[model samples]
Target: MNIIGGPAQDGEWPWQIALMWNNIYVCSAALLTPDWAVTTAQCVNQEASGYSILIGTNNLAEWSPNYQRQPVASVYKHPEYNTRIHDFDVALLRLTDPVEITDYSRTICIPTTDMSFEVGTTCYASGWGSSDGINEFLQEAQFSITSSNNCEGVTSNMLCADGIESSGACAGDEGGPLVSLVDTRWYLVGLTSKTTCGSGADVFTRMTAMYEWIAPILDGETPLSK
Candidate 1:
């Protein structure tokens, strides 16, 4: 958690990944497939450099059997991403190779249809961001999807959530997931895009809106021959 929150329990968010640049945590990302992940463009618009992903671990300070770090092979940012306003803030990272899927590492299920979560829908936000730069454990919080009409700076394509003052994603939490539990399964609906910590509601890029650009790439990849 950033401004306010607690650490997530191990195995709580198996789909979570840490995106790092030159070994420093930059933002959080969601594993969509063994070889592909999604994050915010703001985290990757900079000049290409050494980028890697940490998977299958909740604790970042120490290593475990579940921990696996893989280098990024390529970056694909949404073409319409408006860097000025952080609109359409989404990006995809291709891994050098597919990661091993285990009990502690898994892919998140994304919505297939153009579904909209109504206001007050409960969703979970998870990341590893902190202001003091001391938090090493993954953090998460429960937030309800709200209307962006009153949230200043929020756009139509972004999903807004309330209670960010008391609980929500923090710095370094950028590009992490805002997921909704549907039918006993978690569905990624948004990405932590922008926020003011305790001052205002947090905003996340609606994942469904990016489906058109993401689906094609995901569909083209076949599972590695085991």
Candidate 2:
């Protein structure tokens, strides 16, 4: 629970999803479209077929078995995703069944081709990672906006946030959304990719860089967001 302000208050921009595996592999993911979900490839790469997506709820305890357990129909890992160097760690999952879009469930807005955030823009990240800096079963977590320039030493696809060493996403938060407030709505700017572990920076896959790959899928021309 890497909460910055406090435990996630009940109704904050609720487009969150939980990727579950054997009732143990729990990680938060974001719905990018009715048919696609944006999450870290590492989260599902190991057991792609065994995973289930839980949408339309934030409180896991209240989630029911009937709550939309969509099977992952397909997974599109970024061609550049390399675990050794963590180059492009993002991936897209195509649901076996398209989720019904309602007031509580909707696709998040991706940054337009021209829109971007600078080195200093503030952004917020949320997930169900550990709360006490130790890995635990997934729990609600939050963190304040950190800057991007702090990750100059890593791959260009990775961005950084503020915090000395106490803030940022932890394990189990992988594949979650790194949101940026813009124009009165939060835009999907990055996908939680990795954390330095001991460092404060939580690296994310730059969504803008993969706009070309995700465009066809988002536009319905391609079957997957490759």
TM-score of decoy 2: 0.83
Best by lDDT: 1
Residue lDDT tens for model 2, 110-207 = 77657777766767776667545433223333444456556655666766655333666667677878777787888887777776443566778778
Q: Assess the local accuracy of residue 70 in candidate 2 as a C-alpha lDDT between 0 and 100.
A: 77
TM-scores of the candidates are 0.92, 0.83
- The weakest ten consecutive residues by lDDT in model 1 span 217-226
Model 2 regions more than 4 Å off? 64-67, 131-149, 163-165, 196-199, 223-226
Residue pairs in collision within model 1: none
Model 1's alpha-carbon lDDT is 0.81
Off by over 4 Å in 1: 1-5, 46-48, 221-226
Pairs of colliding residues, candidate 2: 1-130, 1-131, 40-175, 146-161, 146-162, 147-162
- What is the RMSD of candidate 2? 3.4
